[model samples]
Target: MHRSAETSLEDQAVDIRIQMIQLGWDTLTSVPKSRAGERSVTLDEATTRVLQEWRTRQNKERLAAGPDWNESGLVFTHPDGTGLRPSWVSEEFARIAARAGLPPIRLHDLRHGAASLSLAAGVDVKVVSAELGHSTTAFTQDTYQSVFPRVAREAAEATAGLLSGDAARQA
Candidate 1:
């Protein structure tokens, strides 16, 4: 069985290419003008599963709607096939988080969380920056430095250990 780098399932390879921005209730746009925001992101297994489930539900909804289904080709949308407003997404996130007993946070905080968690999980900052559509690794480092102090210390210690071990071998 062939497994993709992002997903272990042979048939579950997902390629992300676009982000959706809704300008109004009826207006949706793709292809961010900024090149940084146009990059693709690899999803983890849980995320892929969630997306797969959502896709299946969406397909069923589309079948039910029949001719009424709007062919938007968006990753996320309202049940009736309309694009979701940014405000609606933020409000829904807060509602769900609150229901789950999570502390209050803006939807954008999830982006920061993703970056910091990835870095702490040993993903290179360069790769994280690219996935986040940041123009440069330094910008990512500077922005997330405060969020990953422990990670920074651990990295420093690891580097020191490597150097000390090398010196011991030479002696």
Candidate 2:
């Protein structure tokens, strides 16, 4: 549920960079920049390890930048004192996607991806809405119906899953 990198770091320029810290990627709460804004974005164990390493590096950077820190208290930073701008980062995204030969996509797709992935994992739509900071569960259901239709259709498919016999015929 990443926002523009700026939104992720809550800054103006993204200098602190993905390189700056070991982002303690554990947990699913770090849905940074979810509709609610910068917050936990629970990550997996592997991500946690990477973030831990990045954390070490961030401290190193802090020491290196002593006296010149912005002190925004954010996990991500701008290298120089201050934060990043969401717009610049979002534009770079499109250029990068085009260069990679992938379909051009808005950065918001990551938000969509989060909802989709959660649904595929059988998580409840309400949970996803809260995670994304949506105002209501219906918004989550409407937004990710592609991933959530199964829940809606579960009853209809119950008999269909039955193998052969009268059940299959009824389905």
Candidate 3:
């Protein structure tokens, strides 16, 4: 989600924009692969509030930094306001996980977990794919189908019910 849109949503709508990222030496660039990667996602209320609070905190830090701030305007940034290095982010995640006594997991794995959660919550596959910046819905389905077996089974059963003229009424 871009910072401006996130802070401006008075009705609690959230938009995710996968427009830029730190890929190798290039710190930021347009969507990585295709147009599908650039999209807006609606966030649940809890996530929206968390982001709003995070922005507020960031603003406080910006004020404290004053002239020292780099003003990169990224949601995640270094203490001096520059973009955070990807490796540093991963290492910090590992350190925090260890401190919390949690099992080890790569930072990237969180993206997969988010996809699974969205699918399990009955969000449409295409929407999840877009939010994940997937090149195609097929890839999203193929990758995540195994993680959301129950939802997939329910989908199959719903299709069967449709054939039996029952799903329409349920819908």
What TM-score would every model get versus the actual structure?
A: 0.75, 0.61, 0.71
RMSD, every candidate, angstroms: 5.5, 9.9, 4.8
Descending-lDDT candidate ranking: 3, 1, 2
Off by over 4 Å in 1: 1-30, 147-171
For model 1, residues 2-81, the per-residue Cα lDDT tens digits are 11232322354443345455565654445656688665567667877887787789788889899999876655767777
Model 2 lDDT tens row, 53-171: 75567667778889997765555456753544445557888899999998979988978887888877878777777666676788888887573566558845774568658766876
| Winner of 1 and 2 under lDDT | 1
Pairing residues by index, what is the TM-score of model 1? 0.75
User: In candidate 3, which residue ranges exceed 4 Å CA deviation?
Assistant: 1-30, 147-171
**lDDT, model 1, position 111:** 86
Candidate closer to the true structure by TM-score (higher is better), 2 or 3 = 3
lDDT of each: 0.71, 0.59, 0.72
Candidate with more favorable, higher lDDT: 2 or 3: 3
Model 2 regions lying over 4 Å from their true place: 1-41, 147-159, 166-171
Residue pairs in candidate 1 whose N, alpha carbon or C atoms collide under 3 angstroms: none
Which 10-residue span in candidate 3 carries the lowest summed lDDT?
Answer: 1-10
Clashes of each: 0, 24, 1
Which pairs clash (backbone N, Cα, C closer than 3 Å) in model 3?
A: 16-41
